[model samples]
Target: MASAHHSRKPSGRASLPRRTTKGPLDAVDDPSLASSRHSPLPQPPQDEASGSTAQQSANPQPSIQHAQQPSVQVGEPIKEERELSFLFDTSIYHPLSQLEVPGPFRKPFLPPPTNETSVARSLEQLDALLSQCEFLRAAHLAGSILTSGTVRPTDSKTVFRLLAVRYSCLELSGNLLLAAQEAKALEDLSSAFYYDDPNVDKAEDDEVLQPHRVPHHIMPFSLRLQALRLQSIGFSDPRRGVSTLYDTAFECREHLSTPSTTPEQRVLWTERLHEVSIWVVNALIEMGDLDCAARTLETIKPGNSEHRALWTSRMILVRIKMGDMAKAHKLMKDSEFTPEDKLALESLLAVADGRYKEASEALSKSEAKADPSMTALVKQNLAVAYLYQGEVPKAKSLLEELINDGHSFQTLTINLATIYDLTSDRSRDLKMSMISQIAGLQKDQGQSRAFVNADFKM
Candidate 1:
C-alpha cells in the first residue's frame, strides 16, 4: 500500500484512499480545506474588501468588537470621529496665530512745557483776576494749570500759592466742604516740602554770623499756616482760625526782621503780617473778646491812611459793642471813614441809643446801592427798629418778607412774638402761636436757647 501511495502521483488525476485512525469520524473527507489549499482562499468579495479598507483608513484605530461588526451598522463611532476632527481643525489648533499681542504701556498724552516767563505771565493774569474779584474764573484757571502737571517741582511754591487763593475763593463762595478739602491738600503739600523735626532745635546760636544767609523757610511755613487757618474757618472753629492767623502774623514779623531779607521781600512780608493781624483782631471782636481784640489792634501800627481808617472802624465797633458810646463817637469822628462805612456806624450808634427813627433813616439811605447780603442785614435792622418804635404792622411785614425769603426762621419767629407781645389783647392768640413757632424753630435748629441772644447791630 505504501508503494501504491507513492506510485499514485504519477497519474494526471489520481484518487487516494482514506485510512481510519480512530472511532468516530476520522474517515470523513475535508473537501473544503482541500479546495482552500488549491485556490487562493476565495478572496473576500471585491466590493466588501474595498469597503473595509476605506473604513479602516477613515478611523486608524479599530477595536476588536468594531472590526467584528459590519461597517454599515457601526455608524456612531465614525460620526463622532468626523465631528471631533472638525472641532479640532476649527478652534483648538494654532489658536494664538489669529490674536494680536499688546505692546508695553505708555502715557496717552503729555502736558505742555512750563517756562519761567509763561508761569510769571499766568501768575500776573491770576492776580489781575483776583483783584477784579473774578474768583471763579481764577480758580478754574489755577485748577487747570495745577492738574496739567507742567510746573517744575522746584518751582512749586507759586502753584501752592495759587492753590491757596483757590481755596480762599471756594471759602468766599460758600463751598466750605470743598474749601476744607483744598486746604488739607495745601497743608499736605507744604508739609512735604518744608516740615522739620519739632524735637530738633532750629534756633541759631550765632545769629550775627548768619545775618547774610537767605532765610528759605518762611514761604512754606507761611503757606502751611494759612492752610491751617482756612481749614479751621471752614470747620467753623473761629478761635482756632484766629490763633493760626496770629501764628502766621508772628512768623511774618520775624521773617521781615531777618537781616538777609531783600527790601522787596521785607515789604511783602510786612504787608502779609498786617493783613493777618487785622484778621485776628476781627475774629476776636466777632467772638466778643473785646479786650483781646483791642490788644491785637494796638500791636499793629497803621502805615497808611486806608489802614488807619480800618483800624479806627474796628476800634469804634468794639467800643460800641462794649457800650462806650462816647469813645465810639470820638473814634468815628477822628477816623476818615468812607461815606458808606460812616453811615453804617451812625446807624449802629442810633440803634444802640434807642433812636429807632434815626437808625431806620440811616439804614434806608444806605440800602440804595448795597449787595444782597448787606440789603438783608439792613432790612433785618430796619425791622428791629420798627418793632421797637411801636410800628407793629411795618415790623410784621418785614419779618414776613424775611421768612418768605428763607432767612432764619428762629429769628423771624422771635421778632414776631416780641411784636405781638407789645401789641393789644386782640393778638394774644397770635403771640402764643408765634411763641410756639419760635420754640419749634429753635428745636429744629438745635439751639439750646429759645431766642438768640446775639446783638444784631452789625
Candidate 2:
C-alpha cells in the first residue's frame, strides 16, 4: 500500500493554456500578444514597468527592494540598459561523461557535431534523446549548443528558449543540483536588463507601456516557473515558488488590465492568472501550510465551469488534509460538481475516513472517470485502497500493470518496490528486473520525472 506521503491527489489534470503560435519564435515576433502559458519558448513582451525582480518579489532582498529605475524625460535618450553578461558565459558548458550517469542507464555515446548546423540539429537531437530516455545525452547536447557561440546574445529570445531547454534537460535527467546552479546564470529574470526598450523615453505615460505594445518578457512563463521551483528546492527556501507564483499572477493581472490588449490575449491572460493563483495554493499546500493554502484558494475567482471545478476540488482536498472532514463535506455538498467530480470527491472523503472498500467502489464507477489524463492517478489510488483492504496480491498486480502500461512514476515505482518487499524474499531481484524494464521503455515526452536509483529503494 502507498503511505500517506505517497497517496495520489486528484489534481484534475490542470494544464496551462495552449499556445496559439507555432513556436516561441512566432510569439516573439508578435509583440502585441502575450504567449500562452504552456508555450515552450520565451513569452513575448509583457509590460516592462510591471515586471517584478525575482529576488525582490519572491523574498524582498533589501538591495533589490531599494533599487530604482532611471529617471527619464519625454525626449531624453534612454541610455542603453546594462547588458546581461551571463548570456555570453561559456563556463556554463561542460562535457557529458558517461561515468557521471547512473551505471545501469549508461549507453554508448557520440559527441554532437561542432558546426553551423550543430545548434539547430542538436535541438532536434535533444528532442529525440529525451523521447528515447537518453536524458544525459540530451543534457550534454543542450550545454554544447548553449556555449557554441552560434546563438547570439543580441538574439535574446533564442537564448532564453535554449536556456529553458537546457534547464529542462538537467532537471529531467535527475541533475537538480546542476540545474539550480546553472539557473543562477540567468540572474534576476525580472530585471530591466531583459526588457530593453528604446521607445520607453518617447512614451509620455504608463499608458504607452501597456502589455499589448512592444517589449514583452524575455523569459517565457515556463522558464520563469522552472527557475523559481529550482530556487526553492535548491536553496531549501520553501516560500520562493509561492512568491514567484504570486508574481506571475500579478503579471497576468497587468496584462488583463491593459485596455489595448486584444480580446483573445485578455482571455489567455485571465486563464493564466487563475492557473497561477491555483499554483500558489498548491505550493503552499506542499509546504504544509494548509491554512494559507485555504485562504489563498478563497481569493481566486474562477472564470468558468472548468476553473470552478478545479477550485472546488482543491479546496476539498486541503480541508481533508487539515483533518476537517466536516468542512470538506460541507464544501463538497454546497458545490454543484459534475457527477464524475462529485463521485471522485466522495471517494477521496471515504479514503480519508479509512473506508478503503467504499473508496475503491466509488472509484470503480465509469461515471467517476472523465479526465483521460487523470485515469492513471485514479487507478493508482484504487490500488492503494485495495492494499488497505488487505488485498495485497491485487494491489501488487495493479501496480505491475501500471508499470507495464508505461506509467512508472516515481511514487508508483516505490510503492511497487515496497510491495515486492512484502511479497518476496528476493525483493532486490524484483526491483532490479523492474528497473531494467523501465530503463528500456522510451518516454513519449518530458511529463514523467527522470528515473533515479533511489526510486527503487536501492
User: What is the Cα-based lDDT of residue 405 in candidate 2?
Assistant: 86
Clashes in model 1: which pairs?
Answer: none
Q: Report the number of the highest-lDDT candidate.
A: 2
Q: Which stretches of candidate 1 lie over 4 Å from their true place?
A: 1-158, 188-192, 195-214, 217-226, 234-243, 286-288, 301-307, 321-327, 333-341, 363-458
Look at candidate 1 and tell me the lDDT of residue 284: 70
lDDT of 1 by residue, 372-436 (tens): 66566557667877766777789778876765454553345555556655665655566544445
- Per-candidate TM equals 0.45, 0.71
Best by TM-score: 2
Sliding window of 10 residues with minimal summed lDDT for model 1: 79-88
lDDT of 2 at 240: 66
